[model samples]
Target: MNLKLQQYINGKWVEANSGNTRTIINPFNQEVIASVPEGDESDAKAAIAAAREAFDNGEWASTPATERGAIVRKIAEFIERDKEELAHLESLDTGKTVEESRGDMDDIAGVFRYFAELADKDGGELIDSPVPNSISKVVREPVGVCGQITPWNYPLLQASWKLAPALATGNTLIIKPSEITPLTHIKVFELMEEAGVPAGVANLVLGAGDTIGAELSSNTDVDLISFTGGIVTGKKIMQAASVNVKKLALELGGKNPNVIFADADFDIAVDQALNGVFFHAGQICSAGTRLIVEESIHDKFVNALVERVKKFKLGSGFNEDTQMGPLISAEHLAKVEKYVEAGVQEGATVAVGGKRPEDPELQKGFFYLPTIFTDCTTDMSVVQDEGFGPIITVEKFRTEEEAVNLSNDSIYGLAGGVFTNDIAKAERCAAKMRMGTVWINEFNLYFPHAPWGGYKQSGIGRELGKLGMEEYTETKHIFQNLKPETLNWF
Candidate 1:
């Protein structure tokens, strides 16, 4: 695939100030696909300066909301026009199945369109005035320059969640895509330019998080910093953003629970359990890695899951028959291995897989066997921590309260799922779960219209829906008096 190998700043494609570059490898076969500029703090600073200048001085911020929405909608049209190529590049970069990547492209386009339609919908509101001959109103305005940092797991999809809203709301932004997976982001920036996004309204900086990401989070000129990644880095960004108290929107991820009640459709429950976690090799932030099952059907559900998991065909993302693909990198593969080892150490029994695949053909790529662990307790590290891999830790619960308790027993509360034939029971569990998103009789299903975020350490703020558009804006109240009367005593 042909890709532009430069940093996009102030509407121009340019190389890093330092002539350093990083080779991007296709995780499917470890083949070097392209080399992109390995930008540093200086590049980030330039991008930030450009965005700051654009928001503070340029016409983008002052442009009519309808015009901004039209640009955002045009970007979605461009995404649709190049969906196939974008899917292929996304698969090549992230080691996800091309089919999954295609679905993500659709969702990404939907996100842009959703924000575009929402742009002019919020024209603020008029409020009743306590004093006569006075008018009071509240309006939402752009938050100036924004900094967005997306992760490698879902590069372009995550970027759209930030980019669409930021642009639609007339905020200038410097987006730093994950170093390992920036191909699609580069393509999207090209499309954004094609959509007539003004110079410096959207900038792309490619580099490691320590340099590019650090500047985005710490730069005082930036009004908001949106991040989607691990908990450790999220906390650091939070601390750094405190320097200027920049508005933050973070999606740190979760060890989300998929609860199966005895009354649920056994076949469907088992099927969705695998679908929830195995999609994209279980790299999703809202992956249902923790299987909190009713004790009565626990063994039966585990057996069904193991049978299906064993039949999964793991291969190249481009292969139509491939059910799962490689992990993003060897480093990430090692992390998954360590988590599996930790699970075993904590006395969880590996029901199916716990080590790397022994297949010679798969050895060249970062492939791990789909693993399932039984006899897991809530206190197990595997059950509590975000594995971010294709591994499930099954924990049994005897009652409804116990199931809810087990599901809530984590520092993260991003998302959870409940499977039950009874609607009341499902609603009860969904209401009780502390997660930001709760699925009833489903899992890992999200769209552009709904708000996505977490309740606790899963991270701050919401990402989608009208609330998402609001994240890139600041609220202000205006009061005007037609007639003024001075007090006689003054």
Candidate 2:
């Protein structure tokens, strides 16, 4: 589908109030793929006002849960119908391989479907009377207008995590996707409209984070704010949310650990380690960028990982054989390069790749090689900070206790992995790890049925599963007098 990129606000596609546009580039070829309206604070306020009006006056909030679920299911159907087009656009926007983009499309559809089926499963709950002839019950209600901010890495997938639950709960929301990757998001909004969503129920604003994001968090009309991005932005959003004391849900980046013990299946561990960080060029928030290995087999594991990294096919996303694509942009490529340089300066060995590939066809694109840093210490910046790029840091531990200590020594606790043949040890490590999600003998695997979030400074609240739908709702207690006269104490 050809896209004339514009913001979707009040159920209509419109230009930004700033009259400015930002060019969206295809990272694989350094070509301009599309241009979208560059919205500002004014545009954000306009969208928020529309959502407020809709929740307060429109039929959306009063709609039955079953009907809302049906609408959400219809939207999922539309996503399935346009899966190929959406996948192509996502790959072009984010510089991920076509296969990965197609997988994301499938997961995105599943998210909407999951929430749709869950909508009518329960309607709050009933409670017993505490006093004679009196009854009390707890019920869940929509949280009114929500302000949602999604990142660029998994544009539509992350948006689905927020959009589906908010809509299913009968709340009006305005979403501001990252300025660089807004194509798929805009397309999904079109689908929502076609699926019979009411006017102003789902709004989209396109712009930079400083303006659009700030307005969404600070707007008094917005009852909740959901953000997924870097730690700095998440902190700012939290402060901004204080303006109205709005509910906040954040999913920030992490320096996740992939722990491999001496007893682990070496071959599978190496493969899973590569899959965790190299996919999407290691831009994922929960990428296992840190590899904490048992000292007994650290050398062997690092050598095997380096060998595999050398054979990884890197090229344009359109190439069917390409295993990895370019970095998201020139700025991101530079950032990754800087991180590699820092690793070397901090006394870490550049075990595999430390520079960009020399292929002439890849020269024009923002490409970075799969990099590995061995002999890494916990004190090193590369091991401590989230590069958000295609780089992995290898750290060695003498004992299981040391490995657990090393994994939990970070400010991030988003996700982690434990690879060991011993199921008991895996379970023990999973329990000790401070992360929100831990994979035993696996890495980077997720489902719609499980909750995803982080501990410590990683972020606040959870997304997905039944807990996700609850994030968009508020609790209320209703009391009634079954057969009583007025209270004389009044």
Candidate 3:
């Protein structure tokens, strides 16, 4: 059965004002899964107005922190109850394996629960007054209405990172999920309403970035804009937000690197290296697509990686045996193909699995085999840019210094890793790595309790942990005068 999705604005499920809609296709089978409203500037304006009114009228902004936390916790409860359905919807929406989609659901629930627990624990700060007749204190308050734009890669997961913190901090929000993958996010809005979120406190607008997203960034009523997507869009959002001097939190792309040393445990490193790039078909922004190997083991490591890449199972997301699902869309599939073609033209060797799987059953879907390009240099397009697919580039480095230099050569500094047993060497490399999050032995292991973000062109601020909550708050100093005296000089 095909589902019809609508925008949620001012606590009501509604259709687009223009009566236009976009069909959502399942990347797994290229079939129509749902259709959502094609929102535009008018819908964004309505959502912005609703959020502003809710914040200005204290509908959510004036709620007691503990009460707000309780409401957020209730949302988490609803998520837990509907996790299975949500997981299936997410799998169908983005063409990820059900297992991975279930894992995203678990993480999403945990994010909400984490913010709920943290909401009331912080009570700002009190400072001793230097002035004899005054008391001074610092307090945190909501940043008013927040406009959030999430990506298609991990629709609801990225939205949770923005929505949970914004709501927990007593702020009203207007969220725009990716036009291509709004199903899971639409389901989440139902959960939020069921949790008793007040009318106009949270609104959803399903639309393209040019209209809804641009309006969100340029709207004066929105006190903050949090966006998660590619670098180009992130820069555009920043430029638009600058007009109003709104607070901005952006998480952009990364051409991350994974460094393997000669002294590293060969078998474990090989396993983790594969885990780094092949998960989610390497669509992750922080996936270690650039592999820096010690010259001594470069040949051996490339051989092992190629063998493993050749064996990856690709099929429909619903299939239990499918280790990796198709790319998000036909356009993304074409882009990945172009990158592989460029890699070959630039003199990189295709070690294994460099083209589409020759299976008739998978032809309808946007499927690409796990690809590895060996004998690569840092200047190669495949190594320098983010492919955002199941592709890896192997480069050889003799020393740790060279490895650090090679890893830091790119404009991105989102994430990197080192695989070695020597504690001191690992520490040195980790310290030298310019990325936001570095792993010594493991790859792609993240927790909700730790801060997640990047350096340089990667992003402007952090998300997750206590810092995530801080992104949605503003600081103000309150002063109390114990005694008032007229100025004699006047």
Candidate 4:
């Protein structure tokens, strides 16, 4: 089937600014699945203008919050009704398993529903005033226009995380999705139209990060800039937003650690560790790529992990037996391979899969074998940086203090996971970890009602919670006189 594509700006489907086009290749098959309108700076300007006008003058911002929420909920309904088609498009466009894409679809729908449910629930709170016969209250107002930049891993889901809350709170948005996987977002724009989001309220612009992304970050008309991607690009976005000092929310890269205590449930730890890094082909930002296992049980844990890793089926995302899909692109696959090579040369041991699948059918794809390396050191690049793929380098820790130190050693503090049966130990681990989100026994799980962001270089601000909606809002204090005036300091 031939795929149809267009850029959504001013709530209309339009061609690229210069009619330049690019073929979006499916990483799983290395096939040109679709042709997308290659956009640039001019398209970026058009989108920002539409969203700015809508927020500044259109009825969208002035509409009741409850009604605005109803529109978001309608978008959720559209997502549910079109899950199969969107999931397929996502798999084709992003090289994810159909199963993974379907899960992402559910996440997208849930995000919209959660934010929609919160639409009309807010009201002003009364407080005592310092002055004689006076009352005061506080109000939350939308922060004009928002510029949302999403990464390639979770296209539709990440977009919903930003778009739903911003819209639910009556803020218009301009979305710049990763150019590599723009198909799902195009589909999302269609659903927004079906949900009756007014023209100029939500707009989609496609282009390289250097051209359009920079403009979105620095656009004086944009009030908030929310982004999710790498630390390098996050830094670039930060520099751009500094031009206007716009409210910034970033969910950047993570070298999250998965701690396995000696007395803990080793089986569960192994499985969660695998899920943490291998899921999404390990393209996630918060992947538990650093496995900090305590000694005395490291050998047994590694053996069990190898057996489980071997049983994982490698194939197309369309197949039910495939446990993990390909990486996002060939360039990413090569980077992962180079990391594995470094792990070997730096004295780490590969305990399981390290090379790509040998099957000819999989040869054409950007596939990489899920790799597990033991005896990994803290200084090694594989252990230090974000692998951003299906590779884990295991390192052993002795004392509790050492474990904490090792986990917190990295520049990134996005997320960390501690697997322990003892409540005290888990709580202590949670307290010591410097990350924004500390998973007691879970990994890579998020809800729209919880704030999602990272500490340190992992990025700033938050997303996906009550706090997330507030990211696009500004608080205003109001004072009123209830009685005749009183004398104050002259």
Residues 369-399, candidate 4: write the lDDT tens digits: 8889998989999899888888888999987
Cα RMSD for predicted model 4:
1.6
Residue 73's lDDT in candidate 2? 97
Models 1 onward score TM values of 0.99, 0.98, 0.98, 0.97
For model 3, what is the error of residue 353's alpha carbon versus the real structure, in angstroms, after optimal superposition? 1.8
Q: For residues 1-490, write the lDDT of model 2, one tens digit per residue.
A: 4775899999889999879999999998889999899999999999999999999995897899999999999999999999999999999999999899999988999999999999988676778877788878898889999999999999999999999999999999999999999999989988998999998999999999999999998889999999999999899999999988999999988999999999998899999999999998999998999999998998899989989999999998878999999999999899889989988999999998899999998998899989999989999999999999999999999888999999999999999999999999999989999999999999999989999999999999999999988999999999998888877895
Query: Could you give the candidate ranking by TM-score, starting with the highest?
Result: 1, 2, 3, 4
TM-score winner among the candidates? 1
Q: Please identify model 3 stretches exceeding 4 Å from their true place.
A: 1-4
In model 3, the Cα lDDT at residue 255 comes to 96
lDDT tens digits, residue span 35-73, model 1: 999999999999999998999895998899999999999
- RMSD vs true structure, all candidates: 0.8, 1.1, 1.2, 1.6
Q: Quote the positional error of residue 409 for candidate 3 in Å.
A: 0.7
Ten contiguous residues minimizing lDDT sum, candidate 4 = 1-10
At residue 394, give the lDDT of candidate 3: 94
- Superposed model 2: Cα runs more than 4 Å off: 486-490
Q: Write the per-residue lDDT of candidate 3 for residues 86-130, one digit (tens) a residue.
A: 999999999999999989989999999999999998898989988
Range of the 10 consecutive residues with the lowest summed lDDT in candidate 3: 1-10
Give the clashing pairs for model 1: none
The order of the candidates by lDDT, greatest first, is 1, 2, 3, 4
Give model 3's TM-score versus the native structure. Answer: 0.98
TM-score result, candidate 2: 0.98
